[model samples]
Target: MNEAKKNSHMVGTVSELSVMLEYAKRGYTINLPTTPARYDFIAEKDGRSVKVQVKHGSTFNGERELLGFSKTPYNKRDVDVIAMFDSNDGTIYYIPTDHVEGMTSIRLRIEPYLYSVKSEKALIAEHYKKFIG
Candidate 1:
């Protein structure tokens, strides 16, 4: 792999590890896929299983105060949740896959803007924090 791709892979690896730790701490059992799959891993708890896709949230747009992450081409049946690792603040965010389905990219506003309409249904990073158990 090229340097950029290699570095990205490293980041993703770290993110997955961190997310696994979080899930384990919350009493969930973690399982890695034996073969190549769309999701990074499977997290099971209370007889429920969720396929998780790990993404490194390393990009931040200062002008818009938004955290940017590219949306992977995944169907609802392929992945259940997206775990985002915020490199800037070491924050882990869990977002339901359906929320970002069919999007090419995600630009999550970190904070609310005054001019922005409250009724707008934009993806806000803070809103996904509730998904973290």
Candidate 2:
């Protein structure tokens, strides 16, 4: 049987669900908002809650990729954390919105580029894994 085609909205929903599952597995209580809002979920644990915005990541070069948090900037009040689901490896990375405050997107590197002497500081996705849960 042929698989059904997926569009952006469908992909986004899948990403949100995937992130929700991950959060649940990590012992978080996932709460979905009833109305359309800036954040996708409100994850709570130990009496603490975080507003999470889910974004899908696309891979470019084999070693590096970019994840767009928003077309426009959003304040920390709108989203406490940005959960990026890597399409390539099924890895979900959590980043506090404050880290990329006022930015539209972030470039993620799998590893350092040794040959480039003036390489920009890399935002490795794996490093952000610590923010999960």
Candidate 3:
């Protein structure tokens, strides 16, 4: 494989491992599917299962953390939650599928000073923190 593809795969694998660790730390049982699945893995707790799709968060234009979902169309039926790990901040953001059902990409500000007031209003970092669990 080319260097870029190899690097991307490595980042994705690391992000998935990070998400699995986070779920395990929260007392959830991690289950890996034996067959092809839409979501990456399932986190089960109290008999409830949450389908998770993990994406490696990357910096865009050296400012915002960009989470791209171009591999597939956003389908709420495919997964319950989307876990994005920001390598820059070492932080993970858990976003429900419903919130981003039809979106192709999500941009998050890693540094406050890099965003404008108008864009900042809609990209408040605090809004996504509550869903970290």
Candidate 4:
């Protein structure tokens, strides 16, 4: 891999490990896919299984956290949830896959703009908080 790709892969690995740790702490049984799959891992709790795709959030425009999700020619993946780790603040957002099913990217700000009535960052963070734990 090229230097940039290597670094990005490293960040993704770290993010995935961090998320796995969080699930482990919550007593969820984690299972890695034996074959190539759309999802990264399967987390099970109380007999329920959730397929997760872990991603690393990076800065965009030097302020917003940007997460890109796509499968080359394919726009969507069959996963239950997307767990994004913000490397900036160490915050993890567990978003339902349906919310971003067809979108290729999403941006999150640290805080809402002073003059704006709504903030995508705040809204996304708030909506996904329920899935964090």
In TM-score terms, which candidate is top? 3
For residues 15-122, write the lDDT of model 2, one tens digit per residue: 899999988888999998999888999999999998999888866677466555487686797999898887667788888888878878766665556575633644
TM-score of each: 0.82, 0.83, 0.84, 0.82
lDDT (Cα, tens digit) per residue for candidate 4, span 1-133: 8999998889989899998988999999999999998778999999898888887777665564455455532224578887888877778888777777666665555454567576543334555656643
Report model 1's TM-score to 2 decimal places: 0.82
- Provide the lowest-lDDT 10-residue window in model 3: 114-123
Tens digits of per-residue lDDT for model 3 on 1-133? 9999999899989899988998999999999999999899999888889999887777775555455554666678998888878877668877777877777676665555543444632344445665433
Worst 10 residues of 4 by lDDT: 68-77
Give candidate 4's whole-model lDDT: 0.72
How well is each residue in 16-113 modelled by candidate 1, as lDDT tens digits? 89888889988989999999888888988999888988777755556334344654664678888888877767677788878888664555666667
User: Candidate 4 versus the native: TM-score?
Assistant: 0.82
Stretches of candidate 2 exceeding 4 Å from the true structure: 1-6, 118-122
Ranking by lDDT: 2, 3, 1, 4
Candidate 1's clash total is 0
> How many Å off is the CA of 59 in candidate 2?
0.8
List where candidate 4 sits over 4 angstroms from the true fold: 72-77, 117-123
Measured with C-alpha atoms, the lDDT of residue 126 in candidate 2 is 64
TM value for model 2: 0.83
